[model samples]
Structures are given as structure tokens and as C-alpha cells.
Target: MKKRVITIICFVLIGIVQSNAQVTFQPGVKGGVVFSRLTNFDSDFMTGFYLGGQLAIKFNKLYTLQPELVYSQQGANSNYSDLLIDNYYNESIITVNNSVKHSLDYLCLGAISKFSFGTGFHVIVGPSLDFKVNDNFDKSYFYSDSPIGFDFAIVGGFGFSFPNGLSLDARFKQGVVDIYGNNYNTNIDNNNNGNYDEVVLNQSFQLGLSYSFDIK
Candidate 1:
């Protein structure tokens, strides 16, 4: 299903490019810092980074479409206490303080629309499809479960470009789907009603700089 969707998007974009005789293309590279956290995880945002490349297709002076491929790092850091049984004497109960850091990496494909207001300013809005490339948990005390393989997010931002083609943007991305698998089970009962936790979502803010140049 994901492959089909990607293929369809590609064909549509190709058709648009072919139909527009005066379309201009610009290719660029971008890198940035990401502040990310998991919602409902009782965690704090973790500082990470992203690097990516993009192709911007301009149909006219005021409207543009940009498709980007990015490698993004996102996750959270959490500290909590839990009850544990000693390995040596299985009956003895112990209160353990645990700190865990989860680092999730994704390869994201984003399709963004830019509505230019003035010479160098634009409003950007887009949808991104993300595939998990890696998931890492740095702790021995807590068990780390992998998140769902795919995620969907909505992104919105404001950007500015210099006359020299140096561009900068700040964006917010909010996950619309659960990052955790449906079978995921959590020991923490956040509601205090003796039920396992619900799904968790990803929330992030990104600040990036890019250099753009005309391709054709």
C-alpha cells in the first residue's frame, strides 16, 4: 500500500512537470536541529538533528511545490521509578530508579506547498510520510519496545529566503497516527484506573537552513 501510494505520487508529479512548459526546478540541501518528544510518555524533549535534500518545482511566481527526502532523528528521555525483584533472591522487592533514552531515526518523504507572500517570504504546509530506520534505547533497566514502522505527520512553517539563495525555516510537525504498534503494552497506568497505556504520538519542532540553486 505504501509503495503504491508513493508510486502514484511520483506519477502525478511527473505529469505535472511534463504538462507545465515553463516550470522551474530548484534542488537544494538542508540540515537542522530537531526538538522531539513522545506524547504521553512522561518524557522530555530530546535534542537531535536532520539532514536532507529537496527539489522545488515552481509553476509560477507565487506558488511552488517542494518534495524533500530527509533523515531525521527524534525521541525522548525519561526518568522514572519502578518496582523490581532481585535476581539473586527472587522474593525480595526493590525500588529501582531508571533512566532511559530512546532515539528513533526516520527516513521521511515530504510534499510541501509554498505560498509566497512577498519577495522572500512564504508560508509552508505539507504532509510527510516517515519510515523508521532505526530505534535505539540506552538503558539496561527498562525494556524498550520498537515503535510502528510507519508514521504520518502534518507540517506547517514559515520561511524566508535571501537574495543569494540562502533559506531558513522553522516548522512544527505533529503526528496524526500512533507511533506505537497496536499490540504495544505499557506498564504505566497513567490514568490510575488499572489499564495499560494508550497510544503515543510524536511531536517535534525543526529549525533548518538550506542553500538552493536553479537546476533548470
Candidate 2:
């Protein structure tokens, strides 16, 4: 699947290059804050930041292809409880209040297609691939390891560019795949089926500003 995604990306890049002769290339840097949380987990949004650079391939007055490389931080604050067995015949009940902060960092590659309407206003939608760079969690109790290292998300947003080359945008990203292994077994079997029934995913909102300069 990774290979297939890489292949698609390559084809998109090739198409962009082939179409660039009639357009312009603009490069820029952006920085922003991200409000992120884990889905299917009892958690709250964690505030983090992202920094990146992007290349915008303007195909016409109304269409553009923007590709970016970004470093982003994401995670959540969670508090929950678990039941443990103290012995074969004795079950111990304990309440676990987890104040631990999880810090997950990723190097992401994203490609967005932009559609412009009036003036500098536009709508953007795209896909992103996140490669985990690092992660840390407070290990005071039984904590699940960070979700599988690679994540994929669908992104959508709106933005406007000023005549002075400054732009502002807000986007929402939704993970299309489970961050945790799909087959991971949870400790709780509410249905008494003896099988795990929980899954975790990633969701985030990003707000950013950038300055673009034409390169061609």
C-alpha cells in the first residue's frame, strides 16, 4: 500500500512538471498552530505547532497545485481507569488518572488542489502522508505504545491571499485509517464476546499564515 501511494505521488509530480511550462511556480514558508486529539479515546485536544515550506504550481488564473513538506506536532491529554487482577482468584479495581501529555511529531508530505473564485479566495482539498519522527509519553502506568508510525489523512480548507503575498488558511484533517493497529485487542469486552472492540484514529485542525514569492 505504501508503494502504491508513493507511485501515485510520483505521477502527480510528473503531471505537475509537465504542465508547468504554461504556468508559474511559487515557493513559500508557513507556520501555524494545530489543535489535535485522538479519536475513540477519552481525551481532549492538545495544542501544538507546525512549520513547513510549500511550492504552489499555478496552472491558470483559477487553479493551482500546492505540495508541501511540514513538521507537525500532535497528541492529546487523556484520563481513564482500568481493572487489573491482583491474583488468580482476586480481582483488584483501581482508578487511573492519567495526566500524562503525549507528544507526537511527524514529517508530513501533503498535496492540495486549490480552486479559486473571487479575487484571492480559494478552497483547498488534499491528502497527506505523515511519517512519525518521534513520540514521548509519561510512563508511570500501563500505557499503550504510540499508534503505528505511519498515518494518512484527508485535508480540506479555505484560505485567502493578500496582494502583498501574505496568506492565511484554516484546514481540518481526518485520518482515514486507524492509527492503532486494526487488530489491536482492547482490555474491555463489553459484549462478553471475548474480543477487543476499540479503535483509535487521528483528527486535527490547523490554522496558518504564509508568505509566497514567485519563482517562475
Give lDDT tens digits, candidate 2, residues 90-109: 56665655476667788999
Candidate with top lDDT is 1
RMSD of each: 10.5, 11.0
Q: Report backbone clashes per prediction.
A: 0, 0
CA shift at 150, candidate 2, in angstroms?
A: 0.5
TM-score of each model, paired residue for residue = 0.75, 0.75
Where in model 1 is the C-alpha error above 4 Å?
A: 1-19, 81-98, 137-140, 183-197
Q: Which ten residues in a row have the lowest lDDT in candidate 1?
A: 187-196
Which segments of model 2 are wrong by more than 4 Å? 1-21, 80-98, 138-140, 183-197
Candidate 2: lDDT over CA atoms?
A: 0.83
Model 1 Cα shift for residue 83 (angstroms): 8.7
Positional deviation of residue 182's Cα in model 1 after best superposition, in angstroms: 2.3
